[model samples]
Target chain A: QQQVKQSPQSLIVQKGGISIINCAYENTAFDYFPWYQQFPGKGPALLIAIRPDVSEKKEGRFTISFNKSAKQFSLHIMDSQPGDSATYFCAAAKSGANSKLTFGKGITLSVRP
Target chain B: DAGITQSPRHKVTETGTPVTLRCHQTENHRYMYWYRQDPGHGLRLIHYSYGVKDTDKGEVSDGYSVSRSKTEDFLLTLESATSSQTSVYFCAISEGTGGHYGYTFGSGTRLTVV
Candidate 1:
């Protein structure tokens, strides 16, 4: 079973526009939600993350809006640039010493110049 | 940037052959993990090690095994490789457990089983 579901297998946005990606989880035990960005030929890196206690978290042009009741979270990239184009993965994990992350299928974003 | 490195960036092996992928870290992190990436599957954990000689299986550990003999190195081996096993393998490390600190991932190893 896919514990985390991410929508829009692929996306395209014009430069300077907004890029949004959404993810939902079935596991209510999940407390930490993290988004990872991966460039071609590279490994996925941490982009942004949010805790269940917070409804929103923003850093620079990247923001994560979370809804605990809905078990959903979304990533918003403001002023999207070509460099921002990559595969994004949403993952959820429960708080523990050995808990592992459960990831979504991932979404490929393309930013047009 | 996190001092994690995956060796043999790419490999192609015949069916039934054995393959081993190596992950080395210079940061002396306490946790090491191996994950596989596929088209429809984002990333599936193969195995993880909390310390030297202490390891555990992940959700998708079948046909794969891992060993951490030292604090800086973790090895993943595929016994009798199969075509279905072809995928990009990534090695990640974390200073703490439960991913509270997130993880530092290596570039990845592209393995092809023919």
Candidate 2:
């Protein structure tokens, strides 16, 4: 049923530009939203995450803006750099012990030098 | 990343053959998971274990079985290889329910079923 849906299977951005990716979920039980960054031949790493209680979270150049009422969230990379080029995945899960996650399809982001 | 390792970074097996992928952790985390990655399908959970001898099936557990005899190791086995099963498998570990603490994934194992 594809619980979480992400848009723009791919993206391209110029250096020093703002890169944005969006995701939406249908499950109201989801309270935690996390984003992962993956590089070729490597495992995914946690980039950033946000909770339904907060509207946004920012770490360095990466930011996650969440809309709990709308069941949507977006990742914005400011001053994008070539090193930021990679595949990004958005995932959601409920709060509790042993709660598994539901992930979106994923987006490949390319930042031009 | 947490201390997670996936053996057989790459493998090739013939149809109907059985394959087992191993995941070992040094972090002593209680939660471990096996996930498969494919084009157009980000990552699908195959199975997960909360503690030794306590395991549960995920969304796509068909044709796959898992066992966790110790908290440090979790194994995923393919009963019979099929071309459709060829995909990159990843092992992840988390300290908690993944609600507060995010997961750390292994490099991955590229499995090819011919």
Candidate 3:
């Protein structure tokens, strides 16, 4: 059922602009949400994550905004740069013994200089 | 980059042949996972192990089997490779804490079945 759904298959943004990617999850039990950055021919690496208790978290230029009631989360990249071009993924994992993380379809970001 | 290594980074095989992908981790993490990545689909967990000899199925477990005889190695076997089995496979490990919130992935193995 694709526990997590991501939007904007591809995004093209100019340098100095902001890049935003959104994700929605159907499972309310999911407590931990994380975003991953992946370059072509490489594996996904952890970027930032947020727990349900908080509404937002920021790491450098990357910001994760979560809406507990809406069951959605978003990743915002401030001051986009060409070097930031990569595929971003959002994942959801429920709190407990499962430890299984479910990921959404990725969003490819192209930050033009 | 997370102390994970997948062998046969690129492989070409004939259908009906038996092929196996190996994932090795130096972190000694308790959890190991195998996933497939495609154009539209993100990462689909094929199988995972909580401990040695304790493996379980994931969303896309069909046509694939996994084994964990040791703490740092997980093996994914394709009993009889097929064209549909062609894809990029990744292995990930989850430490109790630190860098990765969920897991850390391997470099990935690109498999092609003809």
Q: For each candidate, give its TM-score against the true structure.
A: 0.97, 0.98, 0.97
For residue B23, give model 1's deviation from the true position in Å: 0.4
DockQ preference between candidates 2 and 3, better one: 2
lDDT by candidate, in order shown: 0.93, 0.93, 0.91
- Candidate maximizing DockQ: 2
- Docking category of candidate 3: medium
Candidate 1 chain B: worst-modelled 10 consecutive residues by lDDT: B94-103
TM-score of chain B of each: 0.97, 0.97, 0.94
Off by over 4 Å in 2: none
What TM-scores result for chain A when each predicted structure is judged separately against the true chain A? 0.98, 0.97, 0.97
Model 3 earns a TM-score of 0.97
Ordering by DockQ:
2, 1, 3
Q: What share of the true interface contacts does each candidate keep?
A: 0.75, 0.88, 0.53
What value does the lDDT take at residue B16 in candidate 3? 98
Candidate 2 lDDT, tens digit per residue, A1-113? 88999988999999999999999999999999999999999999888988888898999999999998889999999999999999999999998878988889899999999
